[model samples]
Target: MRRALAVLEQVRDHAAAEGLSLTELADTLGLSKSTVLRLAQPLLDTGLLSRDRRHGHFRLGPGALALGQAYLAGIDLRTAAAEEAHRLMREAGGTVHLCVPDAPHIVYIDKVENETAVRMASRIGSRAPMYCTAVGKAMLAWLPEDVFAQVVDAGLPTVTTRTLTDPGLLRTELARIRNRGYSVDDRENEPEVRCVAAPIFDHNDVVVGALSVSGLTSRVTAARVRELGPAVAAAALRVSRTLGATR
Candidate 1:
C-alpha cells in the first residue's frame, strides 16, 4: 500500500506534463514496466487513474477529485467557509479562496473562480509565500510572534518586484492587517493581481486559516480593495462563527 501511494503521488506530479506513459512512469520510478502496470491497474479499477487506450498514458481521474472533495468536506474550516467563499466570489466579482497556513507558506485548499473574462492563475492546493499574499499575511498577523518569527527564519523568497523580503517591513504590514482586521495583496504575488483577505479563527480564538477575494487590478482598484476589505472580513467572521469562534 505504501509503495502504491508513493507511485500515486508521482503520478499526480506528472499530471501537468500531460499525463504519463507507462514506460515513462516506470523509468521515472526506477521500476520495471510490469511493476508499474501492476500498481496502476488497481488504481485504474478504483477510478483513481484513467488511461488512454491508444497512447497508454495515465492521468488523475474524477475519483481523485472526489477524494479531494471528500477530504475538504470533512474539514470543519473548509466546510464552514465553502458557501461564504462562493458567495464572496459572486458578491465581490472575483475569485475567492480559502487557505490555511503551512508553516512559512500558505496553501490554498479551496477556490471559487471568477466568472468574468479575467481570472487568476491560482488553483486548489497551490502554495504561496507567507510574506506577500493577502491570505498569508492575514494568517500571519494573528499568529503568535514566535511562530511568525519561525516563518521568517525559514527564508523568504523574492516572488516579484513588489514582494517585501524585508522582515521589518513585512512585520509592519502584518501589524496593519491586525489593526484593520484584514489584509491586502497589491500585486505582491502576481503582477496586476490584487487580493483582499481576512483570517478565520477557531473556537479558542486561534487563527487557523483565511479567506480571500482576488481579481485583476484593472477590475479591482484600490477603492474596490478598500470596499472588499470589510466585506471579506465579515464573511470570514461568519465562517469563524460557524466554527464556534466567539471573537
Candidate 2:
C-alpha cells in the first residue's frame, strides 16, 4: 500500500513538472505502460488525476485541489482570523476573503465562495490592485499619513476606468475610508466587481490585515454596499483583535 502511494506521488510530481504521460511514466519508472496505468488506478479512483485534457494528457483533477486546500487550511494563523472568516461566510452567504500584505500586492490567504446561484471570482491566492481594492484600501487607510503618501508617490495606475486614478481623489476616498473604518471597491478593480472590506488590528492596535466580502456589482448596489461595509469591518476588527493585533 505504501509503495503504491509512493508511485502516485512520483506520477503527481512528474506530471506537475512536465505533464507526465503513459509513455513517459513507463519509461521513467521502468514499468510497462499497462503497469503504469494499473499503478495509477488508485489515484484515478480518488479523483486526483483526470483523463488527458487533450487526447491522452493526464493532469490534475479536482481532488488535487481539495488536497492542496486541506494542507493550507491545516496551518494555524498566528491568530483567530480563520474562525471569523468561516463565520462571515456562513452568515453572509457571500464570498469572504482574508488577506495579508505580500509586498507589491495583498495575497488572499483564504476565501470562501458563496454558494449562491450567482458567483464571482474570489479565489484564494488572488492578488489585486492595492489602491483600488477594498482590502487594500482598508489596510492603506490605517497606515501613517506618510505611508499613505508613499503609496501615492509609488504611482496608482488605473486598473479599470472606475478605479480612482487621481492620487488626490484617492486621498479623499481613503480619508473617507478611514473615517468610516471601512472601504469600498465600487467596480474599481474589475468592471462590475464590488467589494466591502474592514481593517484587522493586532494586540498592538496596529493594522495587520483585512477581511472582505465581494460579489457582482448588479447584486451589491450602493445601499447593499453600505449595509455590508459595517459587517465586514466588524468581522475584520474581531479577527484582528483575536490575532493579538492592537491599534
- Stretches of model 2 off by over 4 angstroms after superposition: 1-79
> What is candidate 1's TM-score against the reference?
0.69
Query: What is candidate 2's CA lDDT for residue 43?
Result: 78
The sequence of per-residue lDDT tens digits that candidate 1 reaches over residues 1-247 is: 8767767888798877878988888889899989988988889999898998888888998889798667545668888998999899989889999999997899999988877747678878888888889999999999988878888899877888989888999999999999999999999999889999999998678999999999889989999999999999999999988776779
The C-alpha lDDT values of all candidates are: 0.89, 0.76
Tens-place lDDT digits, model 2, residues 47-112:
887666576656676898788667546544533677787788777667888877654467787877
Best by TM-score: 1
Q: Which regions of candidate 1 fall more than 4 Å away from where they truly are?
A: 1-75
Q: Which 10-residue span in candidate 2 carries the lowest summed lDDT?
A: 71-80
